[model samples]
Target: MFTIQQIDGAHAKVKTGADFPKYIQEIKELGVTAFDFLVSNGVEVYYGEEPFKTNSPAKYDPLNINENLNAQQFAKELKEHQDGKTDFPYFVKMCAINGIASWKVDLEEYTCTYFDLEGEEVLQEEIPGE
Candidate 1:
């Protein structure tokens, strides 16, 4: 179960669940007001000043995992891994499949915080804030 709130005229808050397909349909009808979407889909949202770096191979990546590994084998592998490791990549892959290319990080305190590919905080001294 996920909750969705239409905050402003440009953005909408989206959570993840079985209701996502429905939520997206609603948001499309209602019109999103916020830029970031304030997505809290029970998945740890990563923040960066710029867009996420997507690989070319990942761009045309097939959604059907059975092509590489059978469904049962994929399920077994996923069950063995810990949380937050494979989950994010899986979510990214799903987003990509749906043509959701870029995502922005909306931090209340630091609106323009920069993060490296490894998701580490980077401070710029010449940026006036630092």
Candidate 2:
């Protein structure tokens, strides 16, 4: 089972069961490049930890950038994933670009926590059963 929680405008946390790795592999089979996955889905993707800079007398925008995609496409992707028609690597990448460290699994607890770019707990909650 799994649960996802939005931490903020561009960050979220996901808690998943022991089957996380398999889950990732399944999504990889979807054959979507990370870039295409994010843009097509309207989720923003970033490369590294540098904030964007604007030279308005030395004002720095957050180097890290976020995506602004079609909301309908995003919603459609979510629905497809829920129906088991798509994989989640795209979402996983989104989380990582936005600042999630790793999608590590805890064997004993059968769960994992996603951290935001600031290393803060964001998503945490398991499905009702399993």
Candidate 3:
């Protein structure tokens, strides 16, 4: 799962040294890999990974960003992962219920949904790291 909360810290750190697009790309890569590891180990995961477009005064070129490709592609690719293999979010939640930290998940795919163990739906406002 991807938490805007946790990512906020990482994002802030990345922004100081990297362009917004590069920072987002790196975060998505790391976040997906972390989720995959947790899934493989049977651990439940929960987080959001939706990508967004913004005008960054911090960037050297305000128009250099492309939201059409990055955010949409990431979301689409992740959905493809869950299409037939296994329910990514469910897999993570199961691990969490058992107190596991990771499970085997298909690294070939990625998504923005999070795993929930308590059977309670998580809202953007409810993420723990925030």
Candidate 4:
């Protein structure tokens, strides 16, 4: 089992999306099997083995998530963020504005999935890592 402090310490190294893959790798090594991030307030729920779970407190003020899903625009913003053109907070705010309610990353599958306001999967991408 891992604590939120440990996870947050690893996450603090992620200044931009370009740093995400490495962050995931570090946390994965910390026993985080999966994690879900709520876009509105930045709370995260981290999971490990059976019965191992921890929740992170909200990091930012709540933002209104747009009801309309703008997949195309979201994709564009995602690309820019992945390129390190924007910071993490900006990327999160953009996700909310584009109607993303949350996102989940599965360490075992090495996949990251974004969800819409209605909890529908908006996009799923393989995480690039060693």
**How far off is residue 17 in model 1, in Å?**
11
Off by over 4 Å in 3: 14-18, 30-130
**lDDT tens string, model 2, 1-130?**
1111111111222233233345433322332112111222233331112342111121122333233323344345434544555445555444434444433223334344444434455454332223
Ranking of predictions according to lDDT: 4, 3, 2, 1
Off by over 4 Å in 1: 1-86, 109-130
TM-score of each: 0.22, 0.33, 0.21, 0.98
How far in Å is the alpha carbon of 121 misplaced in model 3?
32
Question: Top lDDT: which candidate number?
Answer: 4
Residues 94-117 of candidate 3 have per-residue lDDT tens digits of 334433322222222422233233
Worst 10 residues of 4 by lDDT: 1-10
Q: Say which prediction, candidate 3 or candidate 4, comes out ahead on lDDT.
A: 4
In candidate 2, residue 79 scores what lDDT?
Answer: 44
Error of 4 at 40 (Å): 0.7
Q: How many clashes would you count in candidate 2?
A: 9
lDDT of each: 0.31, 0.33, 0.34, 0.95
- Tens-digit lDDT string for candidate 4 (71-128): 9999999999999999998999999999999999999999999999899999999999
Residue-pair clashes, model 1: 8
Candidate 4 residue runs with Cα over 4 Å from true position: none
**Location of the lowest summed lDDT over 10 successive residues in candidate 1:** 121-130
